[model samples]
Target: MFKKTMTTIGAGVALAAAGVLASGTAAFAHECFNPNRSEQGNAGASHSQAWLTVHIDELTAGLPEDDAECVLDAYAATGAPTSFTIMVKGAVGQDGTIASNNPHPEKAGDGSGIDEIFAAHGADIVGSFEECGVPMPF
Candidate 1:
């Protein structure tokens, strides 16, 4: 019947789509590639390794609020600033100060391009993957 044929085709399409999505997710899951990764440092992985705990408040504070991609990319490239960001999470200030109240202004806006700002001035910032407490995805 036409209904049976259509059902088979729909299932096939769904399976194909799922396969594509799974492959893409796997590829991006481990995208961290640090070219300057050092083996000489004594920095060891934290036992906690909690998500979103990497405190980049101070390091990322200088990043322009509009460009999160650029900031993330630069961090991915150097892995230093990220290392120094923080092992904990919470409200962080532009000056890298942590507070119990008041979320960052840039984080509140839609056009906050933090990464683009960092990427534009990545040469000026300082930090390293050795400083980051956990492994990073480049």
Candidate 2:
């Protein structure tokens, strides 16, 4: 009976360890920002054009030339308060996509969302990738 109890306890410990590891892996996998559910509140609000431009340049500093240019162009065209999210896939510059989700009054039903903006600018749509540095447990 003691041997059987020991075996059961061992099995339970193993299962618990596996569960912890699985949860950690899952957390790492889905750590990216989800704009749909958690949009930045009043992003770029009360910010100057120079400030915004500098902010964007800072964000896209290490990105590919084309990708960075695409982001800049899209932001420029908007001419509104905007927020940018840089998504890097594989490695920075090699594969990346920028998302500019601005809350502009005119954007309603205007087809000027990130996908459309990227498409309009001839930027390659890398789709969604995990955004690192986002707070975990999100």
Candidate 3:
């Protein structure tokens, strides 16, 4: 009887562990997509929207699909240095707020703070810019 009870307990523990892992995986499975031209124009970036639209896929490569999409829109919309800085700052602010994270980095901030987060976390995007002939100002 004791053996049967232990087996049942072990099974329950395994099931519980699986449930936890599944939930964690789900949390990280974000989806990214291409932005419409209108959305790209609205990104408020100083960099050329034309350039961003053409090279977005290259810049965003190797990132989570959703993160790539976020970077594309953010980069395209950055209409000025200040806007670019704010978008980068916002993306960084939302890094720890996993539950609230989304593709719209610009929507995440009040536009205050340093914009170095991209330098640390945006290698693919930055590299794409360099390869495509429009390196970031940082």
Best-matching candidate per TM-score: 2
**For candidate 2, lDDT tens digit of each residue in 52-86?**
11122333445677666665565555463233221
- Candidate 3 local Cα displacement, residue 90, angstroms: 39
Between candidates 2 and 3, the one scoring higher on TM-score is 2
Name the regions of candidate 3 deviating beyond 4 angstroms.
Answer: 1-54, 80-138
As for TM-score, the candidate ahead, 1 or 3, is 3
Q: Candidate 2 clashing pairs? A: none
lDDT of 3 at 77: 53
lDDT of 3 by residue, 1-138 (tens): 996565445434333332343334221111111122244453444142121111233334456666655656565554322112111111235553332444544432223322222322234445445554553422
Model 1 Cα RMSD, 1 decimal: 18.9
Displacement of residue 113 (Cα, Å) in model 2 is: 26
- List model 1 lDDT by residue over 1-138, tens digit each: 996565345434333332343234121111111223233221332222211112233333334554444545555675444432112222235232122232442431122222121222223233332343322222
Error of 1 at 62 (Å): 10
lDDT of each: 0.30, 0.30, 0.34
> Candidate 3, which ten residues in sequence have the lowest lDDT sum?
82-91
Q: RMSDs, each prediction? A: 18.9, 20.1, 20.0
